[model samples]
Target: MSEQAKENPILEVESVHVAYGRVQAVRDVSFSVPEGGLIALVGANGAGKSSVLAAVSGLVRPGSGRIRLEGKDITRWPAHKRVGAGLVLVPEGRQILGTLTVAENLRLGAHRRRRQAAPESEMYELFPVLAERRALPASALSGGEQQMLAIARAMIARPRVVLLDEPSMGLAPKMVDEVFAVIERIRASGVTVVLVEQNARRALRAADTGHVLETGAIAHSGPAAHLLKDPRVVKAYLGVE
Candidate 1:
């Protein structure tokens, strides 16, 4: 960890375990994100990457371990409470309302704190295409456009830490590039980011730090640049050259 990171992390996931019914999806996963840092969590399917994000967003309760934000423990905080505390998740599949207009979907994201919500203009600036289709149903937008809306909606909450799950899933190569660019801009704007991505190469390239999850457990972790060059990581996750 760097001197700046040691000062105080923005988000901490400590030995968390998440289970559903008879199945344990995540086992003793732990990682930390420093303020304004971008941390990439990369793994194959069923590696429990999304489960960790769900636990952090309060969508799923951890069977054990702790989650903290800004030095305070938030392990038991409800989803709404966590959102109010500046933790937000832009879930996979761009879960924007299909029937609602683009503007309506963005408004819903800030419904919890309407008075303090970021102005729509800010969202528009980040995603100008959304501005052009404000009155159209969210379903009408292209895959990339809907992804942009999902991110814009989350941004309206003014999150201090954003958990982004599979932001590049099912998009064209060009669209994927656009999404990664936006993520970079988001990080540059000072929001700590925990990105769970299947694109290990891109994720590692973009992240300040990288963590690899295998079968719900952390298999490796270190500086993103180092992970990108690691022989084991490259062969197992980043693809053989």
Candidate 2:
């Protein structure tokens, strides 16, 4: 990471508003994901968490305000173009290609994108299970394995920032834990992550900074550890005793 990349955020959404026709989904929302760390957005259902991801990755256009990547405004950028610019999204569902084998999916992720000069031995190193199942058709894998493949496919693209939407959804408790462990490893490997999750407890635990969304706006944000300990956060989301 350059000095600018280190000091400057990888992605910044400033005072953005997005709507579906006239039904506003996000209103004047703003947040920043620092380069090379995990920043999570946590909220109740329909709090506009997914909309935020859509706006950032250019799936939805913002009515007002700007989206910046590395200090450059990219609100006008298109989705596929954003992928070339090093922004990628692992959407809510594990959208793996069922007919493709694991290795094929990974190779396709790197399609039209430059491979990392130094191989990501770390990825296979991190998830030894993926290597073991590399030849299986995606549909043959378990739910947890499919989720892992989705994340691994994204990683192979070598994106500078990734937007992850509801990664823990539909996962059993054990699978959820395993998926989160992979997310932590992704952050550790120098990729900035923007995580949108309804599982506030685990999201806050894994994030460096956390944003709490309510009804399409950023209701609260701060350091993860501090927010994790906040009384209101504990009561509403953490279920502290």
Candidate 3:
């Protein structure tokens, strides 16, 4: 990452608030993600992590404040436009089209910019299992494989930043490890990552920074390593598991 981009965050959410009808989902939440760095938003359900991502991804409009990507205001851009501008979100569920062939599903991901997207062969290289089952229906894959497919689909969009919501949510322990390893590879390849995960310890462990949200506000924010050992964080979220 360039020093300038890191100094001035590639993606910035400034005092953003989100509401659904009369109930507020996010309240004056703000954070900046450095280019190519990974940040995790960790909190219990209903704490508003997903709402924050939704606002940024343009799935839902923020009621107030602003969102910027690479220093350009994109608060009102539509979701497809955001995707076209290199902001991609892999939603909570592995939302791959079950009936489509694996290759077909991957092809759909590059709909925005085919030239910039990695070749199908390259995606196959990243997820060998996907290649092995390319001709098969997506439903034929295991949960872990489906999750890999979901990520591969997003990557094919040539994203500059990826917003991951609960990537490890439903998998077995071993599968969860595999998914996180993939996440590491993605960040290593220079894509900024905003991860909202339920597994606080694992998320914090993998992130450059960690934000602990409570009741729609950030209760704690710091370097991931510091958050890992924080007494209050450990007691409230990490637990003794």
Best by the TM-score measure = 3
Q: Which stretches of candidate 2 lie over 4 Å from their true place?
A: 1-7, 115-122
Candidate 3 lDDT at 71 equals 93
- Tens digits of per-residue lDDT for model 3, 177-232: 99999999999999999999999999999999999999999999999999999999
**Tens digit of per-residue lDDT, candidate 1, span 71-148:** 889999999999998999999998999899999999998885676689988999998899999999999999999999
Ranking by lDDT: 3, 1, 2
- Go through the candidates in order and give each one's C-alpha lDDT: 0.93, 0.86, 0.94
lDDT of 2 by residue, 6-117 (tens): 4788788999999999899999998877789788899889999999999999998899999999888999999888888889999989799999998888787777366441
Query: After superposition, which runs of candidate 1 have C-alpha atoms over 4 Å from their true positions?
Result: 1-5
In Å, residue 163's CA in model 2 sits off its true spot by 1.2
Q: Give the range of the ten consecutive residues with the poorest summed lDDT in model 1.
A: 1-10
RMSD of each: 1.4, 2.2, 1.0
Pairs that clash in candidate 2: none
Better of 1 and 3 by lDDT: 3
Rank list by TM-score:
3, 1, 2
The TM-score values for the models, in the order shown, are 0.97, 0.92, 0.98
